[model samples]
Target: MVSSRIVDYHEDLVEEPEVELPQMVFADGEEPVGVRVLTYQSSRAINTILNALNEAEIQYLRESSFGKLIEIAEKPAFSGRFARYLLSRQLKVEKKHEAWFRFAGNPIRFSLREFAIVTGLPCGEIPKKQKMKKKNINEKPYWPELFGSMEEMRVSQAVKMLRKKTVTDPDIRMKLACLAIVSSVLLSTNLKMKMLKEYAELLGDIEEFLSFPWGRIAFDMLMTSIKKRDEISLSQDTIALKGFALALQLVIVEAVPALTEVVQDACSSSESESDDDEIESPVSKARRKTLNPAHAREVDRKSEVNIIFN
Candidate 1:
């Protein structure tokens, strides 16, 4: 059996021992020269070469006899601009690759310099180019095995969008909250396609309906939730309704803490402003004087006016 060990070999190749510090040399009368150390290893360093080449999806061929490796570079048939953009946005690799490969092989140069410039990876450290193989265009989307419960998918989709910073908009946030509540209710009641469709339709009647993108995200979240928990049956409709009610209650319940925080913040800000105004208020000083007056006559007169007004 062939055995292989992965290791870093570059740290082992230093040759010079430590030397004492050099005294300063006068450079006024001397010519200065600069030298750069360029290092390339032969094919004998197969493991090291393989590791370096394996840094990305790019491919390479090794020649042991010649002690050299040749990296094969090719331009993807499609425009890499959109692919690069999506990649920069950190989309899934499959999505990025699929988008790129959809563009057939047009004659384009695969520039490592451009790749480094685009991706911000070191120019010299770029890996070999791999063939961009197109996937089946008609492949049907199905639930993955990892999330066996469909409800998990639903909940998770909402979470994913929130993670993507989609819930920043108030409208989106509210819709997502509503969708979450609905999905939880549906899942709890063991509603499948028919009920799910009706729920979506009812959502349309809601004045501030979520956009298609957000709705899809909400749907995905519902599916995901079911997938995760591995439970989707509503053995008792009453219990399911209770679960649905609980889910809605949870979203509503969050608003209490949120509103409280907002109110507290507003109060604190108002108090701070009042404190700032107090520092320069002559009116406030005069008011304090009236409050602190020690004269019995003045106090009695003010009391008499209060009683007469009453």
Candidate 2:
């Protein structure tokens, strides 16, 4: 794992590596912005949000070279029948950033907590203040009505009602059913990393951190909790491991820059300490192959940093 000190150094702009490659290869006039997501987020949530925003006819700019959520938000010449919007979009995920909505824009900074309420997840464990602001969803979605005619019931009860053979307990069943419908709503986005050798160490480090973080813990808890009640078991670890393995395979092929630098430094010092008087036997001399002019030129052409990236 990358130490907090190392991450802090990068964040503080104390040690920026000199990157020569084109910055993410975006087109001219393009820029990136960071967007923060809320808890219980999923890719479908992102799609739904985008769909709503797009339907509302807003214009925006892409804040990331990659990232699906950011890419769609930033596409050029994308206008709606209503308005012309121009702003950047991208998701900023750090272990420390809590679940909330943060827009990199003026006017009002939207929070995911607010977004959840807007999306009608009012009964899904939000603060009392946020819950008080719930819109008149009475005319909104009513998959809730099918579960049963109930008042003051738990989500578990609603879920039980939906899954049972018949209408056993209407009140308890209705609540659980409502819970199921509400929980099924989409709320976030994700971009699967591309497989490549140059990202090996970065991938490895992220995996190490996320395994013990919310990524793994939340999934584990949700899966375990649901299985006993619904008779539907999902092995999150198995899924996580599969994803980790694919990511690892790509990152493992890339040389770790820090490790390589240490090795090169050691090699240089050892060579520098060696004396010119060092000698080899006649048999050893005969075993050493002579370098051709082309080979010598090739050796001189390689840069240390270039070698590392390769």
Candidate 3:
């Protein structure tokens, strides 16, 4: 039988000393250039060489042994604009690639110069300066007396003053009247009715007031208040509703012509049954009887006011 032996590799584990590479030195007779070159095993170094080569050379390298080196190297993904910038710079191999590598991923923010560097595009130009016109310093403030001391005056006195202002300064009168109407509406139930009645009496001929834009504004306010009747507290809703109804009635009485035109337009548009196609159902007969001209005339004569109470 042949003798068999096994080798032990554990004995070969020895510590090696670190070796330092030699630095270039100038000879005594030769002048030192004072310049040094450094290299990195980084993607930027490979990119620098790749960027310089012709298309054929690049293709040949990519298919040869150098292809493995390119694959193993840490080449950064560059944006189209940033790649153009790198091409524009024409940087050398072994350069400090870290500065350019920092912009590899999406940048959080960038200065205009850095943006231009990466994008290879110019920054937006600054806008031209403009001259401003001076405003008039001596212009007097308008209607200073309208708000001042008016609250201290009695209701009668205020009304008289507003009436006087109405002819010469209608805007101020409208403002004051609108303010009074809003204040009266917001007061407690009893006070609200009292104040509104007083205002109605003070205005005297409601028709004359409704002729102005301010009267239309007051009319709108009254109608809006009526529509919001359900939103009022149950305790005050009755009195408030009555007041709004009365106010609206008074306005409508004054603006009857405009209201009549609207009513006629509405009635004309409603479907009417012709005698030829008329159906004689009990309900239809009753409705026709109620709407008959003779019966309507009798009712109109009895209630000269021509207004629906509701």
Candidate 4:
């Protein structure tokens, strides 16, 4: 289990003996915005509401799936510019498990191993799609309550519903927040995101949901998207990166601390958020009559994140 602070697994691998790498390769461009998860308020709620519950003698934060993640969010906003620059330098590779970036003339590999350390997320293998695609899913506690008649709900819409103050149960709220973070933040990309039914069903047991290897799924989503686009597509004026670009940014930082002063962070830069991710009033009827009602864009199969790993 990861403590409050993320360990430098990258540093452990590099060791205190190796000669330091050169300055990082730099690039200039308009950074594409990843999904704007409602972390600002959601994190607060976790501390104020979720942690205060009488669930156990131990603090809920210690036991939560996203305990370290919430702590990471509080540190600083995602560095979209830096992340984009790193992606631009990605080298072509045959393997899908890891991405190699040419940083300071040295190749730094960002794989599930590095991702787990930087993000403090479990990188366990996910169950096969065939097993997860069981029938009669609507009966699950989360399916009908969160979905009802809505066939396809966007990740943003699900975040909105979960962020509502009306959902008073702390345990329930914690589970929903996990879904929001996974669908909205970790796997965020240019294309509109839909809440996976399989993900929602897992919330039926918070323990099972926590036990799942979301980090592996997130890594696969990001690497697949990167693999999908080559240098040409990344250089195009219409570049939209898939997966959580920030993960790459953090990994880059860990790999080379010298570049920290060079790249511009999204928070300090006050980078304007993408219109699609701007936080909307959960109470807005135009968006959805209720969480039980309308939501998000249809999942584009072409760009849909393939996290159903064997």
Candidate 5:
């Protein structure tokens, strides 16, 4: 009976072992922190310790000041895990990633790449380097090659070339001269009186001269001659001539709207010309080529022309 009882007691002890509850240790003065009890098994006591450690870590993160938080983040003991958690919480709650970035001396020490690695978040792509375009030698005019021999050219030849380049079609020139005269009369009191006196001397009746279109044309032609004289005065390179050019430019500004209107009217009037009858001069063709493709097409369709007559 004693032998049977011993065997039965040994079997019962092997079947069930007594479990001891984990005790959390604290300092002599400090109170013990709370922990979640999962299983009664001693093997699961490690999980309780882990839970206490996690709580301690979270408490450190929460109670600490900004400087202390940075100190804790720099510690290798946490392996950046606490730093990432703190930053993630900050991003979620405050929607401010720049604070941490600013603290880290962003772009230099703590770049987007570092931020991405710490947070396990997607990073922004680096900007691609822009390739500089090579300038077209054929497109640009060589100023030296074109104007280098101008000093050696004859005065008459130079004058002829200048006139050819500066002056437009005869009709356009006349229109611009008319516009300039009208602008001068409106803008200058002295010019207006001079024009009135010239008209009175030539026609004997200034009102009749102004009423007639042909008289207006004659008056504009006379004013144009006066402007040409002023332009000739500019050849001396005097300070007064410079002031005169400035004054003339100011006067011309007043005429721009009228000039634009006259040109548009001329374009409208010439719109009915037959394609076969229209002669495309070299200057006009070059001008057309310089225009934007859409504008060029519009010009071709509308028979509209743009000329620099001034």
Candidate 6:
């Protein structure tokens, strides 16, 4: 009879040399990159908008160009461990700026086109920033109209302003949602990220603003964050990554079928596990020949397009 010892590879575990580094360090060795994703409570801002609006207003928001944002706002925050794990698999290429990750051994590119498909956001070539700035030169500044005269307000403060009974206009409400989503969730560095006049300018012409490639802008920012993390050496202690880090996680989750089951919120119970004891994703098992071939077929059948919130 065939020996069970040969079949049970799980029992063939061997100890590998440790990288010998401090806790929360993933910039070196054979381990996954230990970068953490920093995101704000986007739900709060979204709730504020929902509560402040009437039925017509809510429905209008649902049908707007920025409508998909409502779904993104409610998505479960990506697991920090999984986020780092994806980053660790990022393959080095001849072009330093090209973002690529090895998923179940196949290379997946996180290009702007993929980002757009995953996010359903506009990905224009000319940045929204430049377009907004150019508008400022031509006519009235968008800041005065969109945000009013709050020079030093936090992103939450901007979202909270909508709560006042006076902000009943639909345009103003839409503008508020745009600002809130951008600062509080999309490109936020932290909860205290300040309001930027550049983005506010886009809100002036809602139609034009919707057409502008926000996905490209956001993807670029996300790419920039990844590049920075890549540059960090083993000695650096950069733990937190900002600016739409969740997008990177989202694209990876969309591409890798096995990862869909393992993705968790950053604040979930998985946080309790040590880096060495991190919950292995199914792809990890497949890599080690531990996963059944039949299971892989089931994974392949699941739709790759993971849009909409559950």
Which digits, one per residue and each the tens of the lDDT, describe model 6 over residues 1-310? 1111111101112243332212222322455334433343332344444555567766766676556665654554445445555566565544444566554434456666566765677776875356433443548766877656756556545545555545777787777766666665566655455665567767767776667777777778777767666445422322455556656655655555365553323332332112211112222221111122233334434545333212
Residue range with the least summed lDDT across 10 consecutive positions in model 5: 100-109
- In the range 4-65, model 2's lDDT, one tens digit per residue, is 11101122223544522222112223422211111122212222223322221222212211
* C-alpha lDDT of residue 44 in model 2: 26
The Cα error of candidate 5 at residue 127, in Å, is 76
Cα lDDT of candidate 3 equals: 0.25
Task: Count the clashes in each prediction.
Answer: 27, 21, 0, 0, 0, 1
Please report the TM-score between candidate 4 and the true structure. Answer: 0.64
Q: Report the lDDT tens digits of candidate 1 across residue range 1-310.
A: 0022111111212243243222212111221221111111111112222222222211212221111112210101111111121111111112111111100111111122222222221223212221113324774222222123443344335534444454465444434434433343222333221113223432422342321222223323322322232112211111111121111111111211221121111121111111212112122222110011122123323322221100
Best by TM-score: 6
Off by over 4 Å in 6: 1-29, 32-35, 39-55, 127-138, 231-238, 262-310
lDDT of 4 by residue, 34-151 (tens): 3222111221222222222334412454555556665554433453434444566555556667676654445567777777877677787677742665657555546776667887
Compared with the true structure, what per-residue lDDT tens digits does model 5 show for residues 136-175? 5564422222234332322123223323444344332222
Model 6 TM-score (2 dp): 0.67
* lDDT-better candidate, 3 vs 6: 6
Candidate 5 lDDT for residue 94: 22
Estimate TM-scores for all models. 0.18, 0.20, 0.21, 0.64, 0.14, 0.67
Span of ten consecutive residues with least summed lDDT in model 3: 34-43
List runs of model 3 lying over 4 Å from the truth: 1-143, 146-154, 159-212, 231-237, 241-247, 251-310
lDDT of 1: 0.22
Model 6 weakest lDDT span, ten residues long: 1-10
> How good is model 2 by TM-score?
0.20
lDDT of 3 by residue, 9-108 (tens): 1111213224321111221223222111111111122333333334654565445323432332221211111122211212112212111111111111
